[model samples]
Target: MTRCDWAENADEVMTHYHDYEWGVPTKDERETFELMTLEMMQAGLSWQTILNKRQNFKAAFADFKVDQVALFDDADVDRLMHDAGIIRNRLKIKDTVYNAQQLVKWHAAGKTMNAYLWAFVDGRPVVNRYQTASEVPAQTALSQQVSKALKKAGFKFMGPTIVQSWLEALGILDDHLAKCTVNHLGKK
Candidate 1:
């Protein structure tokens, strides 16, 4: 039951995420968008903090349904700001809506979020063999490319570092430590 060093000492929420969700490939567009939004919200926070508030986020953002969140107006923003269960960062909240809008547009244009995102990795995960936490990177060249493309597409709060973490979480970039049990979970 060995996990990544980062999650080894985490609380139940983080431990479960590490064991069952992190690095597990998902083609579902809504789930991918949800994880991407969470990573953006986690820019200056710990993953545990984001995980703890995930349910609140789902509820606040209409379970991260892109079409629904894309329709959120100023009133929705205000409500989210007053919500105690989720992070009340105004910029992050607004950007969540903006990102949803972009996702919806992509979907309408016959380019699903899943296809647009996975295209960066040629529709497969990039598995890395890091022996320790230190060996893992905060960002990579591929992440920079993806971030640049996303920013150009009107996605806010998605810097290279944030995109890298999102990719790892979505299994586009599998960064499980070599000794971790989930190290072999993603594509080779």
Candidate 2:
């Protein structure tokens, strides 16, 4: 079973992520928030590093529960800063809190992350048929639009590149390689 090029030579954790969870779509808000937070934390780091620390991130960030994370205050930020288990970047940690707050606001407005995001793609995932690893793009115009929209909505650490990765991680953009076996896994 050939995997996506990026995951083919990866470690066990990444291999598992690629094989099982990478592009599986979910409407569950907590899972969506978790994936988005992980992408935000991965800005300057490798995805493998983030994956290795995922459990720690979950623990530190209230298990990716947006409501719980939205309630994070200075004391919580300080605790996260001191936590060695997660990435511990002050800006990223703060942004995670801010993002949760924004999501909470969105929720109060009777909106959901899944509804807000999937709407951009007309309520369906965009399955790309790239032929090789090199053909995969880091960002797209749609990503830029989403980035701008998210920033306007008070989210931080969510530029186009990060947003694109988040979208892919959320299975909104199915980027599995055309020939990779997992390519069709998401379409189902």
| TM-score between candidate 2 and the true structure | 0.95
CA shift at 1, candidate 2, in angstroms? 0.7
lDDT, candidate 1, 1-188, per-residue tens: 88999898988999888888888888988889899889988989988889999999999989989999999999999999999999899999999999898888888888887888898888998999799999899999999999999899888999999999999988898899988875445532
Candidate 1: C-alpha lDDT: 0.89
Looking at candidate 2, the ten consecutive residues that score lowest on lDDT are: 179-188
For candidate 2, lDDT tens digit of each residue in 57-170? 989988999999999999999999999999888999999999999999989999999998999999888988799989888999989999999888888998999999988888
Q: Each prediction's Cα lDDT score? A: 0.89, 0.89
Clashing pairs in 2: none
- RMSD of model 1 against the true structure: 2.0
